[model samples]
Target chain A: MNIFASLSRKPWIWSFVAAFVVWIATILFTGGTSAIGLSQAALTFAAFSILVGIGQMFVITLGPGNIDLCVPATMTLAGTIALKFMQVDNSLILPGLVVAVAIGAVVGMGNFALIKLLQIPPIIATLSMSFIVQSTAIWTNRGLRIKPPQALAKFTTETTIGIPHVALVALVLSVFAFILLQKTVYGRWIAAIGQSNRAARMAGIPVDGTRFVTYILCAVLAAFCGYLLASFSGGAALNMGSEYLLMSIAVVVIGGTAVAGGNSNVAGIWGASLFMFLVVSMLNTYGAGAGIRLIMTGLIIIAVIVAAGGRNPNQR
Target chain B: MKRALPSDSIRLLIPALSLTILLIAVFYLQPRAMSYVGLNLLFNLAVPIALATIAQMLIMTVNDLDLSMGTFVSFVACVAATFLQATPVIGVLILVAAIATYAALGVLIHVRTLPSIVVTLGMSFVWGGLAVLILPAPGGHAPEWARAVMISRPPLVPMAIIACVVIAMVAHFVIMRSSIGVILRGVGGNARSVERAGWSILGARAATYALAAFFAILAGISLVGLTTSADANIALRYTLLSIAGVILGGGEFTGGRVSPIGAVIGALTLTLAGSFLSFLRISPDWQIGAQGAILIVVLGLRLLLNRLENREKRS
Candidate 1:
């Protein structure tokens, strides 16, 4: 009873409910005759949402009024590097994944260094980084598409017992992330750092190193998700990762994670992801094109954020 | 007679240096492209972006950023096109109406004290949708007379360049002299302080938004004439470019100082950069990459400079 009451009081709960209602309405009105394909699509969207949401959650965990703007570029660069490597040699799939993760780590480290060294605000630094990443990706691709290898594609496509393979990957990643964030000493430190960074440093926590690692981990997760997305679609495009930017932020907000940091709810994110997928599906069924879909998504996010209020009234 | 550097004078130099470097590079590379006609093209191109950059700077001054300025420009342009394709007079009216509508929307958003990032983003989508609904495929031209007046070259100098100079001068005067201008700078520097001083922060923010929307409309008008047609993607580039210009011009995210002349110089620099890239016959992909790279470098430099300045102050 206490758990239920506590969950109910969460600001994200209302958004989750709203998203669920919209999703159910979409499924019912659309008539789920093509259940297999729809289910596959829903699963894939849900999985990617979790991956991106986790990245957002990590940044929020640092608190100190921080947000990352380089998420889309980070995801794109990860996927692009993975695809480029896979193209060069068919056997380099695992190695390519490692390279992508390394790239994400470097990006994370660079972001942390810039923020700490120059006193550039986190948002501005991340934003500038995003531009650099996007520009670099465009230059590398040379207006051409890079397709993933057959085996990687199969991994994303092949279903186990009717569920999509990508969906399974998302589930595994989420569970791992949930455990790491909840049961680990690192998780406790994240909570502490978010609540009060100065105090955490005084308490002997490696605040800078911890922040650096969390951002890198976030980027790595996003990269992994990007690889899945690229593999699923068979290739990557210039603007392929742009859609995920807002979606990631929306999921985190909807999942009962305070934007100000120090607190998070994985279950809430999971629920929100599910609801968001349904809403998108419904909007698609109603004959809404990409432009309208984007508009509706933006409006919905704003509405949710407004309901949650800005940056928690109590936090300084 | 030696005089101390006015606070605004140093602010103006940043853009001047950027513009000078860009122009020198262009002229050095392709003197042929520096014709009167080319100069006109540069000025025309800079107008919309300059207006939009000023708009972005205005909101940013209050510690808010509008990611939707581009979409608003597209919306106004498309709506005006729908009405003006047949009658240019009606098109001007439609443009005015669209601007007024967006301004009202901006006021409402400010009243709610909602995060401008999300609100403007959502508004961008709404405006983009409306634009697409009005012109699904981006056809329908502006009147020849409208285009002629906009694109015309004067005997001594390009009319477009003259118009830009005039606008910059007027904006500089108003920014330095107006009561609202002073309040805007105060609010940008510290909104909480102003609110505590018993000023209506909401009203000030709304007025700033109104000013931004007004400039967005002017940008739209210039853009519609330049392309001679309306398209959904027209506004997308301006959003990022405007931010780049504002930051390049030394406009802080927190409001206190404004440099309209600085923004113009930033706009000119951007225009020259684009022209220089084109003269080199670089692929469109490389041009975009270059733009992004330049912005990042500038921002990094700005941060480094600020840090050095802070250290100097402490010492």
Candidate 2:
């Protein structure tokens, strides 16, 4: 009964337990110091996914089949734009971040417009937008390599109390996200909209407005993640942002947020992101090739999704 | 008022109109494109895309999205390049097993009441992994017979154009003009109703998924044939392109309303657009963006037309 109660209260328990087991195994095989290094690396990278998962959590909570598929493209475009604008000067960092944010907001608006004005499905609408964004990124850059500024790179990579600075930022963001979702009226409105749009509209919950805002916010988060990743890597590549697209969705769903909406798991997202990262790290520790890792990740995603689908909110 | 074109005709009209516009643009940009040789070159890569689009259309007809179509095709290509070249019987068995897996996927989706998007998205990774494991890199030869068939040319027309016509006609007849087609579409339109009408919903879904797999298999084999090589990453773009093609061809996400004819034409339009941009000497980087822009503009126009039609009806 105690176990059941805990599981009910914390949907993220499954992921945490899974991650812990994997971490132990990794430590057993790779020694204590290397395990710590893997943990630090995973935690640092998990920050990017946590940011993406938050925005995706909001959108997925918007109702069944409501997803933003343009995240990777948006991130790639943002990174490209940031690299082009940041230059070599340290003073340009703030302006570059602002530019990335603004571009994300605009792209989000475009996604909203496509979904609302044209009544195109969310998946297709975002996908088409992503393609357009990809094109713009590619055409403008042609695979140009511009190193990130010193300040931004330091901000992303530097450690504080053995935790990467970005991880600390992500921690604060997750807390804020948790409070927003669990305590705010706006969060309630989003939850209502997700459960049933028609009912929410009948109850005067401003369904479309909330959904529009959610999509924009998700894009903004993705854009920020792209910027951070570009800085962390010291440069951007054409396909730099591709992996985040699926990773974000996988984190959200595996974090126990119902894919059919009506539920938001802010805390769960943090744990799930860490779990996914650890899975990758563990595979790497075992010297598993990319193909084996790919297969394992795919199988894990399917298994988790299948398990969650059993009690999905959308099912009658 | 007496004769506004029927809605079905209007549905078919859009793709025709867009294809013509694209052809004219291509010809105007490069007069040499009007020749058979030029067209052969322009549309040489379109066959695989058209076949993949048709595969997507089949899945759409059953109200399921196969997000793995692109990677699954690549997996098939890998098998074609390796096993088909070295061991013909093994290659045939592997391809058949892959199709069976697709059929099993449909059953699993139905039984588990799982979202097709998530399931297929996960499967895309699996297929990609398999592809990587099989090829490990970007070098493999297609079977000799497959290469011969792909390279074959006849008088007065490009092989690609002729093949497109034949494939479209065959798909249309099977999926739109036959009894089983009606049943399949019925399953998509209303599964409960189809079940009530004594049709097996699960069976229809399995059949559609199997047919989709079959088409994707063809797409992969032909892709290998054309390129005479296979890579784990080849055909990755087909996932989005096929979905876009289906929608541009007037297919919807909900209902079983898809058009093989329109899908083939949509693929042709997109292929031509890409070739046309290349002919204009635009950077390869911009080619994808240009293709996307065309999809948006065409879909936007279709939406505008829909509004007008609705307004006219009300008046």
Candidate 3:
């Protein structure tokens, strides 16, 4: 494909360019090796968002106006629960993972029930679920401190081929997501449903069931991200998952995933997540306060929304 | 394809029943809550939440969600607490500007067909960042006159309850009883039809959002008056709280089917539920979950009612 054709077809290209531009900007500001160091650290730290962003991208792919707001709370719940179970014995790490994932599934089920049975809107259904899940996290743990298992922590921290294990895990997940979305019948179903759910239903697709599975998949991924992040950070806190609430959605949007749904860009999510992380890091390095950083992030999100052509006549 | 009466009544009935049940439960659980002081304490925070819910309801009337409502309210409170204290003129100008910005956002949303969620989500950070920049910390006194008006007591009714009643009445009259209200609801129910009828959909949406901003600023001012100080995060929870309030009150996302009185009642129900849980000595951690549980169960029951009503109609 020619450059214009590819640019028009591949939405992720924008994120790739944005990430590159930000990287260059960082290098110009910080001088060479230091910028590299910042990039390495940001990439490693951004793995969690990458995982969450990809999951969000999948759900958004399911349809326009569909979203999952429970990811943040689910992640927090999973992180705290994982630490709680693992604190007793490092040998219980596998069990801990299972429990966290189970909890996430349960939350997803609750969201599905609300959205499907009650016919509640996705935002409200998941938001209400988040409140419930977050409350459970707070009630059960009461802000207790528990250490992550030593082995897992070491794996997350250690570098192989100069890349962190967590980052590698994220990369593997991205590849898997790419293949799943680009090469599978399920991906085609999602695309069709996203374009027109009524039409897809008329065509014999199991629209509701597919959406149910997508929600569950999204939640599970978030739970896994939480587990990795908690272990890397040594522990978890109440607000640990708060930032992800908006960041996940922002990354998916910035990564070139259509907000109205029907498209998936796992690679774009990866690049967008890194770009977001670097934006924050760059602001921090410049001694910018939290307020300024927040303002910049908000502005960037708005800019991306406009660039995405939210009012595309075809979709409307 | 007839719009049956039973289903519509059932929709209204559920919220009314839920509010009654909640009120009875709260009173049964805590008998002393019947007194004037008890009522005052129970409803001290309800005014701002109710106001915010009204704001949310207006936007929903236009089929848009204002994700930034909480931060925008907090931003107003920051202005009330700081700039209003330092110089009244500049503070007033800033607020007017913010409301105008909200109107501009409505135009942008309508023109670009951007999802309100994305635009408001992005604006949330902008509003929150502005609030943080204004106060930097949580310490700022509300202007004296505003505080006086907020704290003033009326005979026979608690000030909070009175404020809630007045707000509900005015909003109900404006949005439900007036011709403009009909036009606004028309836009939400069927924008194409409204546009075909030659009504300026853009103007209606912009006006609706401006009204939302107006109510949000009022909520912020009231909040500041009550709390006596403001911070960027003070009203952060109001976003979800207001959404819950509107939904509990019988508002739908796509329809202009919202009730002003129901919104106030819903806000009160939630407030009372929270107070009752605290009275029961449930941990703060559990209180949020309990509220969410209440919301789900109530909404679930409404769903069941709707299905049954529909089935009956079909039969």
Candidate 4:
């Protein structure tokens, strides 16, 4: 096989290509003086997006119409509650992490229950769940800034050998996700279900159980991000997770994950996340106004999808 | 025929029934709202939301979702406030151009086989960015004539009721009764079959998306008219609100099945829930959660009705 053809067949190649081009554009625009700083910032911010993107990828892989609109809210609720619980105490770091993940699990279960039991559409179910979660956050938060535990904050903010700790955490999680998708039967089960729900059921795969687990897993990951984000950023704010809502979905789609479901792109997420951050930074560096920046972002996403996104399965 | 009527009636009646319950609760809590003035004040704010819901329902009728509905509306509102108010011709032209862009989007989506969700999500950002450029700080005057129309009062019924009745009648006639509406829905219900029948899927999609944009524009104009100002983020909440309204009104996500009358009722029900909240004097923090509860209860009722119907069939 031709090298170019084989590389192109891998859906994720376009994202990496785009990221590299954008990275070059930014460095050149800045007179090539701050490549290291730009790369570091891109990696650090991209880490949060990658974490949420991983969770969204799994859920989206479960087929069309499977999405979690509550990711941002789950993050907000988890971060707020965990920070409050820890109350800046260094000794309670482990318990704080557990608390955040637990909150995520509960929210995940509620989101799935709405979809499975109430027969509500996942879009609407997760949306309504987000509402409740957001309200709960507001009720608990009350516009106060509670400091995260000192050790936890230090761990999240500190870098090792010029690599951000948060990025390292995200790297570990990505490896875990890669293994989960490639090496595990559960991964294959979700892909099968996504490709054909009825066929998967007939083949004796547990569709509902797999979907349930996937939803929980996505929420747990979101919650984990929230915990680390609050610690890194100094405290939890009610609106801390708002940007991630779109960022998570955008990176997942732009990274070449199949929107029609059953395809996963773990590596593409990093490429897409880094590309997204760099693109925004580049536009900002060019002194573009918010309006221009947003328009460019939207247009870039559409252009990328048209160029890189394969023919939608539904079309055939 | 008899079997069909029960299921169909159950689907449509539930929305109206919920709206009635909400109205009663609001009136009971604040009896002063039993009067004509109170009624106008109560429902006047829902007109824009009702229009937004109709727009969402129109998109749903074609089996596509418009995540940009709210932002698009906000953009239109900004255009109406700044362009329409300062230079009426420019404003009308801008609105027309925006609607044309919407039609083009439909064509592009069809030809490209792209996911409508991602496309609309991208469009949301574009619209938001444009709106900000037009009015960055959220201060623009709604046209005087539009404000007059919004606040106009006729003899017995309030302007809101009259506007709603007119809206319901027009939407129902265009989408539910007309030949074009039938084809639009047919495209959604079975695109392949519609294509086989010599109708252009692209045309049908373009028409539906354009009509949805038209309604969203109406929503934005009415919103600015009522508030007498325009802001970029003014209608941000309407995206979710419109989605919930469509669902509450018995519109399914993937089907061509949608009811214009039900959508209006659903919008009214949501607006009333806010009124009921104030009457109950709940903390402002839980107000958003109450809206979620209303969504759950409405959906839960449908589930219960389905179970009951199944039990009756078995028995």
Tell me, by DockQ, which candidate is best.
4
The sequence of per-residue lDDT tens digits that candidate 4 reaches over residues B53-113 is: 9999988888888888889989999998999999999999999999999999899888887
> Where does candidate 3 stray beyond 4 Å?
A88-90, A310-313, B1-10
> Against the true structure, what is model 3's DockQ?
0.62
What's the true lDDT of residue A255 in model 4? 88
Best by TM-score: 4
Cα distance off (Å), candidate 4, residue B123: 0.7
lDDT string for model 4 (A1-316, tens) is 6998888777788889999999999899999998988988988899999999999999999998899999999999999999999989999999999999999999999999999999999988999899899999999999999999888989887789988899999999999999999899999998888888889999999999999999999999999999999999999999999989888988998888888788888999999999999989999988999999998888888888877755344421
Candidate 1 vs candidate 2: the TM-score winner is 2
Q: How far is candidate 4 from the true structure (C-alpha RMSD, Å)?
A: 1.6
State TM-scores per candidate: 0.87, 0.94, 0.95, 0.97
Measured by lDDT, the strongest candidate is: 4
- Expressed as tens digits, the lDDT of each residue in A1-316 for candidate 3 is 5978766667777777777777787777777768757767878978989998888888888876588989988998999998898884779889989988898788888889889988887877888888899899897678786789898788878888878888999999999888888898887888889888999999999999889988988999999988888888888777788889888988887787777778667878887888888877777777889889888877777877777655344653
Query: CAPRI verdict on model 4?
Result: medium
**What CAPRI class is candidate 1?**
acceptable
Interface RMSD over true interface Cα atoms for each candidate: 3.5, 2.0, 1.8, 1.5
Native-referenced Cα lDDT, model 3: 0.85
For all candidates, what are the clash counts?
Answer: 3, 0, 1, 0
- Model 4 pairs whose backbones collide: none
Relative to the true interface, what fraction of contacts does candidate 4 keep?
0.61
| Residues A266-299 of candidate 1: C-alpha lDDT, one tens digit per residue | 7777777876787678788888987777678667
The residue ranges of model 2 lying beyond 4 angstroms of the native Cα positions read A6-11, A31-33, A139-142, A311-316, B3-6
lDDT of 3 by residue, B172-232 (tens): 9989899889889999899999999999999999999999999999999999999999999
